[model samples]
Target: MVYSHSQVQLYKQCELRYAYKYIDRIPVPAEASLHLALGTSVHGALEFLYKEVQRLKVPSKESILEEYHSIRNEQITKIQEENKRSQLDQQQVADFAHMGVEYINWYYSTYHPFDQSIVMSTEEKVFPKLDDDIKFRWQIDRIDTQDDTFTIVDYKTSKRYPKDTDETFKDQINLYGRAIKQNYGSKFKKLIAKIVYLHLRNEIAREVTDEEMEKTRIKYSSIIQEIIKKTQRRSNGDKEAFKPVQWYRCDSCPFKMICPLFAHNYIHDEAVNLDDMKPTTIKAVIDEMAQMAYEIKRLKEQKDSYAKILGNYAAEKGYKRLYGNENKVIIGKSENYSPLPEKKNELESKLASENMLDDVVDIDRFKLTKKFKEHELDYDQYQDLVKKSVSITAQRPSKLKEKEIDEYMDIIGEE
Candidate 1:
């Protein structure tokens, strides 16, 4: 199984999507949103700036902006050529590109001298195996040393700043800091992590204590264990290994056409099968899939999305289905749901008396939690329902901690 904050977070958000992406190796939509474009261009510009600064020369602000423009323009062209985005038009793309440029310019003005620390590496790959079955990799954006402290700097370009209290971002820095500590133990007396908000022209820095690093390792190891357990169960013919957590996120998933819940009504049997596909058949099918992905993205972006308006309206009218150009939209609610909290105990007792307790509930913790909310269950009720459902996850020391792993080599010492 693959491991990264993004991948693990995706599994946590929707395991079915994870299976589609990692297990099935589905090709994601080629057209990126403007937000992604900004991050990519900014990251490229900063990588250039740091690499240049480390060589004992700081480029003029104009020169740095010029590099940013080149990157943003090239990326915009690539995005336009892909024609994968439905919500973003050409003008919006240009505007987002300009926004990135402005942010980079602001970044330059804020850090004009570029003398805070010596940049050791940018976009360095860190492949640290957690355990035998939990091997994975990640990339550190930047690592710089100043005095006794080594700073793991991550450049974040976004309209909104990352929440300082968010564990995801915190864990992200920890992952980088731990990697640095493991590989460059003798080089620095202390290690700290910084998330540079390029858009805001400020950073949120923190010291990733040894305790936090160890906790993060255990936390990450547990997620990997759950993923491994699900995969093993799935291979042994457990069809329930990955279950849907439907929401707006589904609107962005590329494999929606073939996703079990939506496929029967939304897709034809003629959809591409990558396993048996020939080179000649790839382009046309993938292009079509991208179009469908764009359509879904567009619908979701609309103020009155189809899922809400059409599906709900049709269901209200007691219509089982509605027709579009060549597809049928299934209008219905899911079945086998638990009762509302106020009535849950009574219903549970009834089911138990009828010998239907196990057959009546989905029993998956996350799934049950979501189901509980949809049924208007109280918070305490949801907690009670899920108390016994939390699965235990096994943990282990990373291969690096045990000195049974590959070394970072030149990345740790590169100038």
Candidate 2:
């Protein structure tokens, strides 16, 4: 079995989305977002900077920006050529490209001369196998060493930097640190992690405790075991074991057009009969809809009727979430990120400095960071180089065939 943190997260997000991409291997027709395209460029530029530093050379800001723009242009062109219809428009593409320029320029300005740690390696891939049949694989963006200390620096290009307690990003870096110890026999006295938010032009550092490092290995192994069990169940004839997870983020999902939840995108023409579902279920569904209609009528609410009718149909059917032409149906509660006290204070201070505390429509962290930099020390020349960002999707995972699971188990001496 081959798995990674992202693969596990995908299973958590929606098993059905995982099934569509991995099990069915459907070709997703979604366009690449600006966040991802610019991130790709920033990562490459950082790698180039380290490689140059490793050779006892300093990379100028212009050269680094040049490399970033070059990579961004190449990536956008390749995305367009491959996805002629799905690729982003020229303005959208330019906006993303602009962000990469700012991110790289800021990154180079902050961390030149490589004083933080001795660069051990960049873009390193680690494969840690627990047994003959199971292996966990992931790539570390860059790993740096100082004396006996090992620091895994994960780069981010987001408008909002993650809190120190953000589980997803924190666990990912910790997983890398533990993997190094497990697979490479790295015995560093200090294990640290730094999330260098390129957008903010600052770094968040944490010393990884022994307890945290050890737990990462155990938790990661548990995730892998779970995936194996799920795959075994599927092979044993659990046809619908993998079902779609109904989350509101479906609008951004590449598989949304093909998801069965939407109904219209699914091309099946099979007829349904009342005889198939239990009489009780059919009656319950009708009764629920009838009750909702009555309530809507009694309340004299015209537009709210559809929500009752459609939402009940979704809830009563136990379908994950409801969505089609427009995702008007509400399946469950929703969530969004809220700034913690520290973030709020920091943002308020900056807003106060600019005398726009009340004029704040919605705080754009990217623009705010740029504004502070320009006010403190002018860099209007780099104004055109600024960029925007959102969260990026995970990369595809490695595949292992189900037919080989048994043989692989035998080779690993499993019963």
Best lDDT goes to which candidate? 1
Question: Candidate 1, residues 1-415: lDDT per residue as tens digits?
Answer: 4577778888988898888787767788664656777888888888888889989899887777788888888877777667744444778777877777788778887887888888888898885556566645788888888888898888877557656576888877777777777788788888988888876778888887988877887889888887877777678886667887877777667876677754533422243457656544433564556677677767778935757798778867888889889888777676685478899899989999999988866656677577653444546655644553457542331223221111122223423
Kindly state the number of residue pairs that clash in model 1: 0
Question: How do the residues 134-179 of candidate 2 rate in per-residue lDDT, one tens digit apiece?
Answer: 6668888888888788888899888897675767786787777767
Best by TM-score: 2
Please, what is the whole-model Cα lDDT of each candidate in the order they appear?
0.74, 0.72
Candidate 2, residue 362: the lDDT equals: 66
Candidate 1 residue pairs in clash (backbone atoms < 3 Å): none
The TM-scores, one per candidate, come to 0.62, 0.63
